[model samples]
Target: MYAPTPESTGSSVDDRPAVERLRHGDRDALTELYQRHGASVYWNAYGVLRSRPDAEEMTADAFLTLWTRRREVQLYGVSVLPWLIVTVKNLSRNRLRANQRRTADSLDAADPPSARASAEELAALDEAMALVREVVDRLPAVDQEIFRLCLVEELTYKEAAAALGLKHGSVRNRLSRMRTRLQSELGPRS
Candidate 1:
């Protein structure tokens, strides 16, 4: 869904020669490609992650991936920028998910649950979680992915849209409808 246009890289630069040079173990070709598209790739990562350090790291990782996966890299038209964009997008999302897991683990470790909680309370919590999962499972496949990316993964609307290749408004509207449906199904909290 991400069609590569002449403006995607801010120029009509052909990357075939550079890719060929890279595939032949030419480090200068890698440097050339980086100089050509590094900013676009970094900004793409930053747009998704909103963190300078993470974006910089992801930018480095993206170029590394391009280097390591040189033999397998696929070019769209004459430019390798599309492949780099997709790589950075994936790297940014992975970083986000890992950070989310680390935060959750740290929080859990910081605040051990009170052992004095009643069995009834634990059972109620389990039941509510089960109901939520069941409701989410009933959604269409794309909607289910949207839910996971937006809610469970905590990606911004723009990030989710870029990952899912949907428009920003479309992701926002679908998520709103999904929440409304979920609330209606679950009813008000007592």
Candidate 2:
């Protein structure tokens, strides 16, 4: 059986060696550092973005930041985990905000307020449903489901929350955000 030692109990001792190596511009040392704290950084990004590919990219960017900023970083307690987590969070937010900007720009709610679709355009529920699907699909997965349930399906907020294993307030809030996005895209209702 393996036994714990002073070295095995904490990150302080183990991390110092890798940090020292990083100070020397050693790629292997950066790899070691990533292996140690990569999951924490990835989780930080994933928790914010909720997408695997984005999280993976965020993790890589965080480690790259660590390598680029190695000489500038002061490791007060011998671990770079905190710095990595902060980097992950900042990058993830930037990516998410950029995506929102793209979505908002793509919306192009620029038609004159008085403009209206022709009766031929409104001949079928299929057209309206397709439009709703296009807007809702732009949201994140959880938000898409919540909006579909609470709005499209006409489920009560409480019922949707229960069905989706979320709090009532959470369901309500997401629905509110969904409404805001649609309002911005389609303009205020008459």
Highest lDDT: give the candidate number.
Answer: 1
Q: lDDT scores for all predictions?
A: 0.83, 0.73
Listed in order, each prediction's TM-score against the native is: 0.55, 0.51
Clashing pairs in 2: none
Q: Give RMSD (Å) of candidate 1 vs. truth.
A: 12.2
Candidate 2 lDDT, 51-93, residue by residue in tens: 9998998798678667766777667677778777777887677
lDDT of 1 at 148: 75
Q: Compared with the true structure, what per-residue lDDT tens digits does model 1 show for residues 46-88?
A: 9998999999988987887787668878787989988889989
**TM-score quality measure for candidate 2:** 0.51
